[model samples]
Target: MSKPVTDRLLTALQAIQESQGAVSDTALKALSQARSEPLYRLEGLRSFYPVFREIAGAPHRLQICRDGPCRLKGQALAADLQVALDGRQDLDIEMVSCLGLCDCAPASALNETPGPLPDASTVIEWLDNAHWPIPVATNNLQRLPTDPYPGVDCRYGAIKAWRDRPAEDIIREIEAAGLQGLGGAAFPTARKWAFTRAASGEPRTVICNADESEPGTFKDRHLLENAPHLVIEGMLLGGVVIGASLGVIYLRHEYHQARRRIEEALATARGSGVLGPDARGPGLAFDIELFVSPGGYILGEETALLEALEDRRGEPRHKPPFPTTVGLHGGPTLINNVETLAAVTTILARGASWWRAQGRGEHAGLKYICVSGDIKTPQVLCLPWGSTVAEAIEGCGGLSDGRNLLAFSPGGASTPFLPPTAADTPMTFDDLRAAGSGLGTGALFVVGTGRSLADVLLAQAHFFRNESCGKCVPCRVGSAKGVEMAESALEHSPAPIEQALETLHHTLSRTSICGLGQVALLPLVDGLRRFPDEPSLKPLKGFTTGAD
Candidate 1:
């Protein structure tokens, strides 16, 4: 007979504890024997969990960006080589969301190698020499047609269509659809539901994190505006899965249009029995309410979002007691990104394996990417995971002036830049990480010719400085110092600029508590590294330092 999973986990934990953090190979083997089921269960722990399945051999998994910005900057080609070589059966192939590495455009990776490179040159050299394979490339995958129901009222369209379906069936369909979260993390939806269902001691709560604060990413707003019902259905389904009676749509304040649309949709869903008690026939008792967030980039972080929901100042909390375990007024809460939950409706409506088969291998499914900056049509494009960045750009009618691309942010402002030399890499998570950047939120900010790298860094620095929540010391003081240094550099004080940059980099990267501070420094650091020829100092127009 097989040992119970919990017992196995306990045994493994005991061995690890006894070894003082260094379990022997034999102990590790025993642990692995015990870990099989937990690992499977853990696979669906969240969107980011399963992607690491392939990289379990390595101590860490690095996800890079091969989306629009990285592609325009030649990350696609580099990613392609990595995918081909790393696509072996033993290795995992994942196409992650953007990692805010557009400044380092054609980035590549050295996964689980541990320790930072001595310098940027060494990192680049290591990437250049890495043995990457040439993945089987394709042009572009076809997009699913928007399924807007005909003759249905705008408010009731989503609810009416799903009204007749059993909540369990809907949830099961979602589970079978193999839909992962789309909010950059790509967590499995079914697993989130299962965890929330089991973990919640009281009535569970569902929150849709619409705080799309990542610069260069606006796909959530598009979904909220155009397909509010889809998002609602997803939330409702989550409520059912977790036995929740209430749901909240936490949207950012700047998304006024989306908020309005969602409000109307909520009213329609409730009035028409798509939501509310006895929704859509009998035994369905779930409803969603809309709440607008006072806009701040930090509020988009999961824990911060929860705090904001509780009417507290928006700031992150310590984890280990993750949101899934305890959240939202000290109850078990399930929070999902706007895009991630939207995909849930489709998953529940469709079958998981069917959804899995929709895209190219590794990047197996559609990814809706928000392409902005330097493009003629800055619109959302839904394509398969393995599609190249060149394909997306061409599909969007190429750059505005056909100018040479300088750098692009594949994952938003925090992501490093990718130059135009690596444009053919596959847009898979593994491929992107192998390239050197991350596939963070799929926001592609393209930088074109004539844009000063220094100016870009300063602008981004100003944003971080303004958005710092004054919570942790690193972010609070580092962002302020960074802005001061950036301004001084703009006024020709190179020493202060360098000092500020170094301090900000260490504080944000090494000590900050959340993804916000860590990623916020990408553009600033990469700008200094990539644009050596660009003037680091600008003369002050009216000041004479010698006279002063």
Candidate 2:
């Protein structure tokens, strides 16, 4: 009936799932009686989240990524693996969405341990030997611009430097640096903190959204794994500015490496008096807790994340009593993503002028770009803001196998894919927006020649469709319908496809409750409008019925 019950519910369910392989009927009944909650509520959670199951699953589960970069690299990996291991009763192979490891194309997790997919023989060998390869934290912190302590031990200097100063001054410094939400929302970071601080509510909370679940976006994961101290310091700084004692990091469950790093960082901070009851001296209490999500892409949406914490189905809530004013447990909440919070620490540790000067041209500050798909070297690059998309491609060693660039999605899946001509566009919010796609999460998904634009575009649309929370009608039905129409267009031909998709996109954008619904069909809808002359799009327009 209260916060404690709600907070422990997901954890308890997870524990049950882990210990027994699933949440059984008798277990749910026992939990309902103990917590005094309705059985239907518990049932709703089990049905909504992908992590929970009604019955025991195979002991060893292999979930292979079938979205975006992974799909482009090896669309048949999961299927082929399934075919190879067909008779194994001890294991189950499932095709899943992104694993936040797009850099390692054709990513898969064996029994919740993530790694790049290997051949069936090697995997079987590992299973036989009782050894599985897992993702390890990459040691590239010194290369990133946002790491204030690059080569040295993190000292939490930012908090000590600004903890005693007026909160307004800290806000002014962040605003002067022109810091915006790096999670693709692009909301001004200073404005968010100020609003949350000014709002009248006790237990005002600060949250770092570590759930970067989109297919082409993994920069946040990199930050969480490599520069966790910066993230922790940033959230502590937020707690100081917002006058909040409690902070939560809503991390996606797939990031096993990141979870360990963050937990270690949190423990280190607490031991050093950087977080806890008297974190910044007496009367100023602040601490952060890491909350791993049960698993869902929609939970990346802020409101949907809140719903999960409240022990409800992870569905997006309607806005306009936004989280800044009415957040967790009816208190004002300040939520920023992993990269955004890390930038906060860097901006504060260094001066605002120093941060502003880090960018190229008129843009301000540094940006982390996740470059993948058809690139010679798939990786994350921390570049100055306003660096052109062409520069990003070059940094990733250009197109794979000397192939020419056909198109590129400047941001993640929700952003529209632009033609090769748009490569020179600067990697800023307004610049990318002007070039026909927004700088979404600073992710660049490049498509090389000889690849089917229709297939690539359809995959992006299907990602959204698969991740939709099904709370609202437009998103749930429209996303599915969009995928269906695109599939039919690719298989056969449809003349009204363009017009129908445009109408559907319009309806979803205007009527859908959250961003998940609003931008579900953006890739396909925009591709139809932008790439009329492309050979792959001809079938979608009913001009040709031949294969792409």
Name the best candidate (by lDDT). 2
Q: How accurate is candidate 2 locally (lDDT)?
A: 0.88
Instruction: Write the residue-wise lDDT of candidate 1 on 358-470 in tens digits.
Output: 77875556777777667776667777778877777777788877776776667666667676765676665566666666567877677788665556566666666667777
Worst 10 residues of 1 by lDDT: 46-55
- Could you tally the backbone clashes for each prediction? 68, 0
The TM-score that candidate 1 achieves is 0.67
Error of 2 at 531 (Å): 1.0
Runs in model 2 with CA error above 4 Å?
1-7, 134-143, 150-154, 493-495, 545-548
TM-score of structure candidate 2: 0.97
Off by over 4 Å in 1: 1-178, 280-284, 495-503, 530-548
* lDDT values, one for every candidate: 0.60, 0.88
Error of 1 at 126 (Å): 57
Q: Give the worst 10-residue stretch by lDDT in candidate 2.
A: 134-143
